[model samples]
Target: MTRYWPRFNRAGFEESVAPIDYLEWYIPRLEELRAHNLSFSGMQYNWNVLDLLGDTIADIAKPYMGDVDDPKEIIAAREGVNIENVLITNGATQGINIALLTAIAKIRNKSNGKITVAVESPTYAPIPQSALILADDVIRVNRYPPKDYGHWRINYEEWSAALKKSDILMITPISNPSGWFFHKDDLAWIIDQAKISNVTIIADEAYNDAYREIDDYCSIHSVAPNSISINSLTKVYAMGHIRFGWIVSDSETIAIARRIFMTFSGVMSSPAMRIGTKVLQQSSIVDEAIADYRSKNLPKLRSVFAKHGIVWNEPLSGVFGCFELPNGIHSELFADHYCKVNDLLVVPGTMFSDSMQNWVRVAWSIDPKSFELAVDALDRSLELALNQKQVNKSK
Candidate 1:
């Protein structure tokens, strides 16, 4: 047997951080709280892990031993068109990987068998990174400004031109780092172009339930019947601990994805699949989780950012909100400094894409009190970074 490091694209080089813990970087603060000490800095908030796992586990574990041929409960819960359209996996990350491999396999025999995946500029890192792993080339289309951030706006002409050359197009309905919901009209146009160009659209709707209004959000799967939709229980259900996700598309796509899954990993554990099924079937639990995020946590996050003079695209839905930092502070360095010195953590805009270097992503799905602490820490961190930069320039 030979040992080889996995080849990763540029996006792969960035380290992965749990979205919740990433914001509360201070371990000592947490320890103090555990010891029943009152803290001034406010770093102790986190998602109720027990609430997420305890409620869903029994349902998830049931399908494994039961006589059910298909997880009807989970299938109906997702509102998927049919059982054939759904393929469960470890998480949305797994769904993305499967989608890429399936796309490559389908196009491997074509003239330019090498797939070109087009992604939105300032897109989620995994989109381009996954494409690079599975395709010959990756093209990026910028949808928002890099420096002073704003809403996601697609340049239809640019997208259409790229569509001609691309074999796959990846988008997040409610984007990760941006928290910008795609306009229905833009999504419709993209679908039309994809159909004409023979490009497979992979819509990562991991944050699907995070929208402010559920009605306003449109799944790419809805517009492009052939498009592959990827979703997970992590964001919407606050069940990241369960590590369950699924892919939805036409029957053919699901079959191919299943074959690839068998070849890659003999079988997904019965446990994960069962748990996923359980979460999907429990509609009330899912709805309650969504409501908690929408009504309570989101408003608190928006006010905190506004109070600090930070602006973001008011996410119509999703767990995250993206904000731009004041001038002279690099997002990566600022994030690193904040985490290390101030016990606060945030994803640098650079992690999302090169064009997002000046931005930072804040996950608001955390406890509201913890979110407040994170916001306060962020305010102080930004001021320190700015002041330090000015002092250096004077020298």
Candidate 2:
């Protein structure tokens, strides 16, 4: 057990927000603070503290089944794919790890135990960290910069150039933290180019299954045979506690993935799998209920954000949106102090990208009253941050 992962065992790991060490150090501290906290650093929308689903999945002892109504089957059918391609996993993070590790296994011998990965920058930190651990090189193709919602394109020239060289293309479509939607047409072109270059594709579509969309977006698996799609119930479904996710790919790809998976996770969680099945069975009711909650409260939150001059892109799909910290406060510094003083949290965008040091992600997934309370707390933190900037400036 020599810790077989792609994490760099070098110095200066604490500096960047996207590195693995930062997340490992930061998350547990957040939990400890939450004894008296009201954090917005969440992925889901509209959850009640009390049990809502009534104990329906408590009796699962066997492996889950059904190419229909089963959680894996439900996701497969909804996405219009086959059950054989669906992989029921513990969480989207696990799904990502499996996808990357399986792909790495194939390239290890040929590339001398390493491969090149091209990841969309400003992505969820885990994406590149995992890739960095598994690949020889992880080239970051910066996505569209923040505050500009009109054009959310990758630099085609940069992306295509990288696609030609990379052995794997890993991306978070309708990503976490930013909720930036990669246009389906652009995705198609990328997938096609990846195919020509013989690169395997993994679309981490965890949020797409959660949020509402303006322009319909499809996962790359639908258009490419070599592509894998990952998703979960943690976000839009308000099922974070359940910790269920899955991967979808063609039979050959999934076959290899299943082999790698057996070495780690022996079997999917029966109870969570059952609950996932339950969620999918009732998806229409559940999805609409959460969407309706957002429809009611998001406008109020937007008004508050505008009043404070906090600018953000309206999320096209997920519950999270990145906001520029007013008065040029570095996001990591603001996050630490914001928690100490406010008893609440906003994830620093630096955790996703160092380039996003001036921004923080805001979540509006809680009930309106709780959201209002978080906003009120933010009201105080915002004022102090602004005033502090002036005090330092005048000195």
Q: Which candidate is the best by lDDT?
A: 2
Query: Any runs in candidate 1 off by more than 4 Å, and if so which?
Result: 1-73, 145-150, 298-300, 386-395
Listed per model in order, the count of residue pairs whose N, CA or C atoms clash below 3 Å is 10, 1
- lDDT digits (tens) for residues 59-111 of candidate 1: 54454555334653465345547777788777888889999888778878883
Identify the runs in model 2 with alpha carbons over 4 angstroms from their true place.
1-19, 32-58, 61-69, 106-113
Q: Give the top-scoring candidate (TM-score).
A: 2
CA error at residue 26 for candidate 2, angstroms: 3.6
TM values, all candidates: 0.78, 0.85
Model 1 poorest ten-residue lDDT run? 35-44
Clashing residue pairs in candidate 2 (N, C-alpha, C atoms within 3 angstroms): 6-133
Expressed as tens digits, the lDDT of each residue in 173-193 for candidate 2 is: 786567777766777788778
All models, RMSD in angstroms: 6.6, 4.6
lDDT of each: 0.65, 0.71
